[model samples]
Target: MPPADGPSAPPGGDEVDRIVAAWRRVAPDLDVEPLEVLSRVARLAHHLDRLRRGAFAAHELETWEFDVLAALRRAGGTHELSPGQLVVQTLVTSGTMTNRVDRLERRGLVQRRPAPDDGRSVLVRLTPAGATVVDAALADLVRAEHRMLAVLPAGERRALAALLRRVTAPFETTARG
Candidate 1:
């Protein structure tokens, strides 16, 4: 098939295009329009995950390590957050976060200290080394993503981001736990 988007679609078509074409042939009654957009998003997500892994690995960091370190780095000012806050931001259970913090602490990437104002509460702080690694990983991740999005003009990228936000907002609001 020539694909749905006419001249704008890639001349040779992609895997999603082929899948849509095959599905159409078997079930012509169904509307496969959604696949053209969502399937591409799914594939892009897979590729992005790989890029993230590579970027983190280059910094000698694991994905979860990056997540926690990045969260702490983003905490500004003191570069620290209570363990509970870290759990929420990293979206992990307290036990998992505790183990991660322990591992990271052993590597000198983070430290736990009593909250200054609330001695009973403990806070996880990203060490300078952790900040450096997370920052480098973030830069690499952004550069890779920019390369992938280079095919689109700025305006189109903005428009696509807006469209994706609309698609994602509901799920984010509901599925965030």
Candidate 2:
């Protein structure tokens, strides 16, 4: 049921709408238009992170752990990649990647072995346990995501995804530290 407040916002308006409304009332000249889109994106990202945390935790994994595992799982049949490669795919510093790998190693979710071509470098391989956990977590994540987007039709979801990709393309292409 909707809130029985003093005055209801127009159809489909939400909390962000209320905020924008207030900002509009306060600063009639300033261009707060961007907030209408970016603010909701920020709020949605928060919800997504929370949902992912719950989904991954149920599979005994952390968000970072799932990221590494998912990277490996997408690395074709071998399901392995060099630490440098993992760093690139995960957008983490090499040092951070090493620490992440160390923690994951302790949890028995990944294993390190000498690279076939490079004697000095080692490749990180996802253990069977890792694959199972990541796969299950992914399934759970997808189901939650599906429910979240259920309000939108299938075509809208695809279009939204494409639009999001366009919005994210610049960030994805930019160098990260």
Candidate 3:
């Protein structure tokens, strides 16, 4: 099926088109518009997830490791955040975050230190090794995503990004509230 915007045909549109066609045949009156866009998004997400996993694995890191390392790396100079802050940034439960920190510490990818402002709380800092691995994994993931988007021209890619932002912004805005 042709994309709502862009070229006359999708780069590899067999499955969505076939599925949509079957739905139309079985239920001609039903509006399957949502299926077209959402099904493709789900499939693309699955593909992207696999690509990211492979990219991280190539650097000897898991998705959780990359997530925690990235949060600390983005914290800048000190390259550290309290466990509470990491939990917020990584969107994991505090218990899960602690487990992740423990594993990363064991791997020598991160270190823990007492928070200067609050003696009872600790900070998780990215070690040199963690920064190196996360950075490489992020670079690989970007390259892989770019390759996956090769079918779209620059203008169409921008348009699609804008469209997706419109679709996602509501959920994000609601979450912040």
Which prediction has the highest lDDT against the true structure?
A: 2
Q: Where is model 3 more than 4 Å wrong at Cα?
A: 1-13
Candidate 1 per-residue lDDT, tens place, 1-177, comes to 455543223467788887787777778899999999999999999998898899889999899999999999989998999989888887889999999999999999999999889989899999988888899999998898899899999999999999999999997887574
TM-score of 2: 0.91
User: Alpha-carbon error at 68 in model 1, in Å?
Assistant: 0.9
Q: What are the per-residue Cα lDDT tens digits for candidate 2 across 78-124?
A: 89999989999988999999999999999999999999898998999
Question: TM-score for all predictions?
Answer: 0.87, 0.91, 0.88
Q: How far is candidate 1 from the true structure (C-alpha RMSD, Å)?
A: 3.9
- Tell me the whole-model lDDT of each prediction, alpha carbons only: 0.89, 0.91, 0.89
- Candidate 3 lands at a TM-score of 0.88
Q: Candidate 1: lDDT of 94?
A: 97
In the range 6-118, model 3's lDDT, one tens digit per residue, is 23323566688778767776788999989999999999999988998999999998888899999999999989999988988888899999999999999999999998988
lDDT comparing candidate 3 with the true structure: 0.89
Indicate whether candidate 1 or candidate 2 has the larger TM-score: 2
Q: Give me the runs in candidate 2 sitting further than 4 Å from their true place.
A: 1-8
Candidate No. with top TM-score: 2
